[model samples]
Target: MIKWVAAFLGYFIFRFPGAVLGFIVGSLFDNMGGSNGGGRNVFQDLTRQSVSPADFELNLLSLCSIVIKADGQVSQRELDYVRQYFLSTYGKEKANAIFRTFNDVIKKREVSAQRICSYLVQRTRYEVRLQLLHFLFGIAQADGQVSKAEVIKLRELAGYLRVGQHDFESIMAMFIKSADNAYKILEIEKTVSDDEVKKAYRTMAKKYHPDRVVTENEAIKKGAEEKFKEVQKAYEIIQKERGIS
Candidate 1:
């Protein structure tokens, strides 16, 4: 559509009357499309102002593939995480289109790490990119462990995003640790007596109570909720195992 419009405008721009007619026709076309103008001139102006949706979608898929392949082997769990994330963020149809683009890139083996990193740096804002890194880290840890390959890839991505090493390590540590595992997260042992389990849960619950953290900072509330949930899950697992519940 843009190409044809540009060609028509180019051919019609030579004569005074033709130029005037072309300008009016181009304005009409732009208004119809809700664009500032029609043809190459309009496109150049738009390009200078913002990133294109196609570029955003391509970058998103490339980042997903990079994180999924980080574990040396991509497991069903990881793939499911990606699929679920896409479904949540985008509708199923759009997610499928994005997935197809990702597969195409993999099949061709034509995409380079440098190219992807460059595009991400140029196109994404800092907070968004950081959140994306956290999402990747969460996906990597979803199966109860993080592989060395996954950690390396995460660091590589951190480098690309220009996230400081200290900040990356801090966030990575939070995810890699089994926040979902009650016993591990609370530092309780499987062999701990029923009373000990209850005591640990009480202690950890007090520390992670969402209200307490929410007062400190809104962001800390999320961490607090995760920790509190872990405490509950751990207590339940232990109680069930010991036949207390």
Candidate 2:
């Protein structure tokens, strides 16, 4: 549909900037669908700003393959995690089919996380990329603990994805809980005062707030909600320990 419109516009309009604008707007309209009776969608203005939803899912799955292979061997639990993610995000029938085909492609390809992630970071939004890292961490910790090699690779991947050190550590804290892990979850130092902890909690709570993705698709919005909940849990844990209301 977008291609048809672009082609027609290119043939008829046959102008430089006009044709280009037509192409871009056509693409956005295709993504927005006819749901609005030609009314404005909140995402229409930003549709061409990033990859389409399908491409986003593909990029996420491709990167996940590299993360799953980080420890040199894939475990049943790890595979199950991927399946479960698909099952929940997609549905049972589609998830099983996608898992089968996705497994085949990843099995045949030898992908480097850095190489692919470098490309993704340029085009993908920060929140979407963070969700990919979130999924990767979930997969790595599926069996119990994240391996040393996995952590190294995940950290490297985080770097390639342009995820900030504090954000990466905060996500990591969700999966790996140590004695002082709560501080990491809040992206604060342990030496900070009670007031500082409260402040950090407020800052993180705003940073990971699900409402930030409210304009996104349902699945992506749900991922943000999960992140928001993790932040809340960490804050609650610290609040209980510090005897703060």
Candidate 3:
């Protein structure tokens, strides 16, 4: 449908050749599951590669730089946390190469969160973006606390990435401990009945399940596993609090 519409528009604006080119480009978008795909089935098949591994690392580095500098004072611990994470995820050599680029070039400039996040929104799945947010929160918490400034920047990035408010708050609650953090993690209100709470837990568990994150990268899979555990932990806390068996 998108290809046909684009072809028609192109033909109207230009000629036969324009329609051909428009259709070719539209097919690419369709295969990769464009913005309308809602971030599902991204890179599901080995033959269809939406974004390259290099591009993923670079964009991720860009986001890291944005969050690291958000609090006005760049802490070494935060920097090391980013470095160590990438190092552990991608082997030593690739991670070192990425950080080299990051230190010399990417980190020195003002990264446009809107542009980077927009690209991510189109290319990556929602589950992948959730892990990206989780990683950023880890960076913010690396220095012992998540500052107000960092939270503001993270929320802005999340909005730009088109992540829903409930999902954003759920990840945020995982790091920022509070009396009702469990409820927030479950994306439900404390006023809801036990049955509703159970339902929400089941929903979140399925949503954040490690298997839902389809990737060959062990680090990404592990991150999803950690997220799944957090959901389970939130349910446990709620169960204990409400005395639900």
- Model 2 lDDT at residue 121: 71
TM-score of each: 0.52, 0.75, 0.79
State which candidate, 2 or 3, has the greater TM-score.
Answer: 3
> How many clashes (backbone N, Cα, C below 3 Å) per candidate?
0, 0, 0
lDDT of each: 0.62, 0.76, 0.82
Q: What does candidate 2's lDDT look like per residue over 1-245, in tens digits?
A: 88567856775776666667777878877866743332222222223254554555566677778778888887889889988877876689878877886687568557666767876776657876677788789899998889998999899999998999999999998888799888898999888899999999889888778776646456566767888888888878888988988
Error of 3 at 175 (Å): 0.2
Ranking by TM-score: 3, 2, 1
lDDT of 3 by residue, 1-245 (tens): 77888788888888998899889877877765752322222222222235566676677788888999998988999989988986776669877887898785434766889999888888766666777889899999999999999999999999998889999999999999999999999999989999999999999999989887666666777778888999999999999999999
- What RMSD does model 3 have? 7.6
Query: Considering summed lDDT, which 10 consecutive residues are worst modelled in model 3?
Result: 39-48
Q: Estimate candidate 2's alpha-carbon lDDT, on a 0 to 1 scale.
A: 0.76
Report the lDDT of model 2 for residue 216. 43
Please write out the lDDT profile of model 1 over residues 1-245, one tens digit for every residue: 54346546656666555556666777666655664332221112223234566666676667767777766566678777777766655669877876777677545444565677677677555444544676678778877787888899889888987876644754565566554355664555667788887887787677556665323332334545665675676678767777875
Worst 10 residues of 1 by lDDT: 39-48
